[model samples]
Target: MYRLMLHGGVHVLEGTFVNGAFHKPLFFFCQTTMSTETDETRQSLLLEQESRHTANQHTHTEGAKMPNRKGPSGASRLKKCIGLFFEILYWLLTLILVQFWKACTAVALSLMLTYWLWGGWATFCLMIAALIGIFYNLQDSVLYFPNEPESSRLYVPPATALGIPFEYVTITTPDKVHLSAVLFKQRAELAPGVPTIVFLHGNAGNIGHRYMNLHELYAMCGCNILAVDYRGYGKSEGVPSEEGLYVDAEAAVNYLHSRSDIDQSAIILFGRSLGGAVAVHIAAHRHNRDKLAGLILENTFTSIPDMGSVLFNLDFVRWMPLCLIKNKYFSIRKVSRIQVPTLFLSGSSDELVPPKMMQALFRICGAPSKQMARFEEGTHNETWRCRGYFSVIRQFTATVCRPGSNVMEPSPSPTPGPSLADYLGRVNMQHQDV
Candidate 1:
């Protein structure tokens, strides 16, 4: 049966040609023995049938070797597209969930705060709003809040109301900012070794706001007093800044030094609150140290960031970076460089600047002699009202300064420090001459 199948007529003969083994003579012989068919028709039919059978067999073999290749290729491309879509969807969902979590946390915090402390929470919300506003408009916020900048016409200092005659003087800073100042002096001859107090007042009001302290210092101590208005505060030109205020202080010192009536060697820098930081900054300068007699700081904080923590008493702001605080009067760092004698007057009950910060400053002082006068019953603005305030100032000056003692002691070569202009130039603060 197998041999008969192999020899099975013309179909079996066609297989030889299809397999590429038929000689031309064998094919011609097979055609001639088969029939007298036309050569063209027989060749054409045989070639067509053989070509069709060869193609079908080749395709069947390929299909067997690589089953489902076309179907899987199309399916894989579809799978890739679906996977990319789902990946994008997952990230979108994650982003939405994160935003929703933040919102929920904020709402929960607000509700808890409102429940526990209604008034404080309201104030906190207001403060948050104010901070957001400040972040958006820092320049205007610094110009406006915490400081009351009024025109000179609005406030006038009483020069002679307390019988200690004071002269209204105008001075110019190195930056050419004009400042209004009051010079308080005894009409009578000043006692020997009596110091001139270059008073720098606190943050909020003009120098005239300290009339009580001025009157008391003059009547009680009989010392020379010169108080100047910082820029943007009580008739001074330009906006207020930490460096601008420092320059105003320097200008005040220069004005006092220029005066022949006032002794340069007996100049004492007296500052309260913000003024205290400015005074310390002035006294820390290598150029100003020789001319200064002594230093006095009352109710001043360590730094502006520390003061913010103290002021707000909030955990969130307690960790506020010092770089973010625009008005960074870092008195603690500056006080360690002050070479003169220092007197730190701390009110036990100071609401704004805590007594601990003052004590920290007192301990860090690098002065030859430093003392702290504690007012047990005093507060921030009323430390001068303490019974021994004037006496402490008088005694401190008498002990630290002497007549013709303007000569500075030979210390280590002083490191160069940043000038007021240099400090202000680095930040986003601009002050124009008026």
Candidate 2:
């Protein structure tokens, strides 16, 4: 038996040669002779014996000779001691790295759950790296928002014909964040006390990207809408922060409330993505029952941490630098305190913020007129543009999203998928129906 060190690690082997047969964990390029019964049998037996005796015995013998030359030298003893210390240290570090690998594995397993619900190429890349035992930097690889703002491909109506028109309105927060806004209302054709809503854009381009929502709420659903850009977005000035966004939302909502053309009794606040948390903040603290109507939250979650949990493999992060997330954007903590009708929208394929996290927000809401609708294939920003989202929002506006009334349709379960096979089957069924 022998213990060997190679390939930066250690291996143990035990072997024997008997009746010209070999057994060993080591391999060598030597030949051995065996008594011949037949040519094939003799060759096989000789190879087995050679394999059994295989090892770098030359190297071992050389080491043994060096010790013999030392002849009880303290230098030899010292060298042996140093070698032994390093061997133990190497193994200890390896063991620690192994434990780290497992911790990384646990974190990967948690992310697999989210990936299973909303499979994406990025998640697949991360998972593949994990399975290969690579020490991937989850924060550097995953928790980053891209540096440059993405350009939107849609048009911003020079004056969005939302109804009550002021020409390309410019509004400012008390803290001096300038928000460019457009308001729409029809007093007689649109009921004076009819539900009024505000549009909060996602963390992408300006209000132009939200035109589908604007057109639906304003022209089709017959609700007054005030859509504004947060700071650092669209024509809005100043950089955006969690608190700064709230101030922007407040400025826009207050702008509507102050308007004589738009009725305050029917005022509703709607937020998308980051805006959803902003809306919750307003509904929880700033909203007056006498002034505001209801709430609509689309593709939003409980908080930034709740979002981080969904977006990344979080177990390792539960103790890591994730603790430094100061801008909580925590809506779930505040939603239960809100006192109005609330409608929640979630997207089945929302990779940025999975649909399941919405359950936390729904669970905490205090309003009786709370409704949640999920678009089967919608991601974070486009839930309302999905097939059923427009109709759902329109219906919500007509019924539960009404002024001074906290009424809502039953929210669907927040579970995400049926399968790709299922989506294909439905498409074929729809063709048959046609």
Candidate 3:
């Protein structure tokens, strides 16, 4: 059966037409032989349609003629105009429904949170006003959730829907857990032993959502980037845990190792968020530094406790005394052992993982080549601010991936995000001039 869709047409066919195809015409001979029961059914349908149409027209006429005269001398005409204005506004909002869902959700959630925090029905009475705010904002919430519209317009690949170029490969871990990953190769003009970078995605979402960043790295950085899905992420099999993800990472490494064309020494590990933990673990523990060229960590913390303290705004969490619990990505401990060159990047305004901790990790990394780039205004996951995301990465790849050219330089500090006062000040200044 074909789907009835909004853009295609409005199909309000009901009753008998619901299941069968109304568009299918009968052969001339078959039409002539059809029974009287069908004629009776058609007549009943036409009468129902006519009655509904007449009732709708009558309702419309009555509504058009009615007047809301609240008082004898009050501004009744003004009231009518205002009512009409709101009716038209409602219609427009209905037409553009998706854009306003987030604002609505935010207002509702805010009021709920406020009440939940405040307690008592007396203070909760203030929530009524928030319902009005929620009315407008709900539209924005809807817009954000359903397959972000802009990303939909991108060219996604077929083997997987994410649009990254791939050749299917299966890898077995040293412990023999099978894993799946897609390899994205660059159309290169480079020397034969070009560096290959394997991407380890942040914990949580899968690989499809990361194509925008991946597309840039492949096109500009010109590295053979293999973005692997951890266990239970994307199309990959098995459950995800600290140990499971590490096993997955090892499998991905061994897969790269099996390839004859890939230079073992030129392999670079690029990890984002939680992937940084895994990458640092592999780089530090596995005796493969001679075969590994470099490592890059973006928006990553030093240990889980450090990240937890940053998240909950408590320093004591970071001071936990456990052996495994001390390190965030545990990069701080491992960074000292990592002899390969490294690049660490963090956003200053990162609320989740504090930038200070990332900076601390940068200082601890004992690499012949090491650089820490700080984006002063960037939020968590926003690589866009750090030299278009691609530029800093390309520079890092060139510096660390090449054997003799172990270049490392300070990345420029990023521009700040606009403050609230700045926006209001501009508006106030404009009005004062008049």
| Highest lDDT model number | 1
lDDT string for model 1 (332-388, tens) is: 788889888888888888876778998888878888778877877679998777666
lDDT of each: 0.69, 0.63, 0.62
CA displacement after TM-score superposition, residue 143 of candidate 3 (Å): 27
Which is better, 2 or 3, measured by lDDT? Answer: 2
Instruction: Write the residue-wise lDDT of candidate 3 on 1-434 in tens digits.
Output: 12222222233332112235343221211122223336775577458655665665576579789987765555867898899999999999886655445445435555667788977685476566566556433422321121233342232234454344457766666666666677775433342356678899776555666766665565555667777877655556565567777788867876788787566667888887788888888887656676678888888878776666766689896776564241235667886777777877677778677777777777777777777666666677775434444556666677666564322232221223322222121110000000
lDDT of 3 at 70: 60
TM-score of each: 0.60, 0.55, 0.54
TM-score of candidate 1 on Cα atoms, chains taken together: 0.60
Cα displacement (angstroms), candidate 2, residue 178, comes to 1.6
Question: Regarding lDDT, does 1 or 3 come out ahead?
Answer: 1
Comparison by lDDT, 1 against 2, better one:
1
C-alpha positional error of residue 339 in candidate 3 after TM-score superposition, expressed in Å: 0.5
